[model samples]
Target: MSITLTQLRAFLAVVHSGSVTAAADELIVTQSSVSAAVSGLARELGTPLLERDGRGVRPTPAGAAFAPFATDVIGLLEQGRRAAVESAENASRTLRIAAVTTSAESFVPRLMQAFATAHPGVGLTLDVGNRDRVMGLVLAHQADVAFAGRPPRDARLEARALHPNEHVLITAPDDELAARAEVAPHELAARTWLLREPGSGTRSVNEDFLAATGLAPRTLTVGSNGAIRQAARARLGVSFVSRDAVADDLATGLLAAIAVTSAPAPRAWHVLCSGVGPVRPVVATFLDFITARGG
Candidate 1:
């Protein structure tokens, strides 16, 4: 038998939720129906996709490989359905956005408010996460468009430079480094740095800047922008963060910008969308709106 959308959905739910019972709850179907769907899908593919776990289930190797395909298929089908519905009902447009944390906390609100004022009927959904998570949403087709501090490298993604993103070195107002007019690059290697997670765009940029300047400082990893800011405020360590992210703190003396002689040059914030396919009307309209406003 040919594979069916329902079967794929059921299989994906099970894989994501980790159990037939949980998948049934998510799909709003009975456990037996979910079980039957998984069985049917496995039989159609001539391989077992799942194996039992302790009191739950896990994907077999074949299932793990198929997960991306399953997510992509579901995403595409949902997009098509939304496109059709929105084409017939112009007032019911929906746009989805994924944004990096810095943008999400700073500029995204103003952008969203302006867009809503211009197109009041369009329903908007925004997902705010770190850079890696936002990129993953775009790759998974879960977001119609994304805003990020750095351009993506994947062939499936297309990006436009929106605006300049300036990263600045920050320290507690009382810290010794804050009073310097311009800290030399050689002096930077001795400072304790509060760093974000390894895969973060901010961290990557900081690393690249350090590599170019031959400065390697001791780092204490913090997961979130808020945490990093707090750490810097408490004099736990100094940090590099988006100017937009620390604007209020800088203004109020909660944090002070440390002028460094060899600081990183401004990088462009990017507007990214899938390059491999046609964008939906809502997505197109939002892209045009943002680009016109210089993002």
Candidate 2:
């Protein structure tokens, strides 16, 4: 007889639990049934997978090596079962998403909540990172979809504009720099400016703004939005961030926007996908939800 997935699962349970009784309890079968399954599996593979040592069970060297493979097989099989059930209930269920840090915080969570409400059976995974890391997730097929300020120029990806992102300079409410409605890029050139890391999309936009005004500050790189926001709150300097990210701070008077005359207009936020193929249904659903909400 062919080895069944059930037999593989039983063997894995026994190996993981390290006792036939425990494995039986986990599998909801009798200890004898679990032992029979393990023995059958061992015979099918033509190897001794386990042995009794004193009053406990231990895996043989071959079983120890095979245990991981069995675990993986059972895991994939269980995932398949779950997917099949979900498909029967709602064929659109799936997982795989990537987003730049700012959007991940400001927009992605709401989008996910909406999607979850619409498709309760769906499995979801959201990858959050900087611009380059998010793009890398998409290209590597680690994520089926991604959200970012702008798509990379790489020919192997497809990007569609989802919304407009306005950049603003933010400072603590009590900060000396908060009084001005606007500050020239050169005015703070000598100051210590908090910024996202070099490869961040925000940093890139900030660089363009500085370049346009022929000013570059002494930048202190902090890799995350939260870190940069805290730095700005501590009056470490000032930072240019997405208007959406600082909305709460703006509303509560914790931070103030610095108007810059030559600041660029709002840029487009794009949803990026690998050019490798058509978008998955879950990814499409998320994109549709975000775009519909004006992102």
Span of 10 residues, lowest total lDDT, candidate 2:
74-83
**Model 2, span 155-233: residue lDDT tens:** 7688888778998888777866567776666777876778788779998887787787887678888989888888888
Scored by Cα lDDT, where does model 1 land?
A: 0.87
lDDT of 1 by residue, 1-295 (tens): 6999999999999998999999999999999999999999999999999999999999999999888788778888788888888878444988899999889988988999999999999888999887888888987788999999877777778898888899999888897866878788787777787888866888887788778997778889998899999999888877779998999999999999889887888988889987755788788888889999997
Worst-scoring 10-residue span by lDDT in model 1: 82-91
lDDT of each: 0.87, 0.79
Residue 242 CA displacement from its true place in model 2, Å: 0.5
The runs of at least 3 residues in candidate 2 whose Cα sits more than 4 Å from the true structure, single-residue gaps closed, are: 1-92
Model 2 error, position 167 (Å): 0.9
Among these predictions, the greatest TM-score belongs to 1
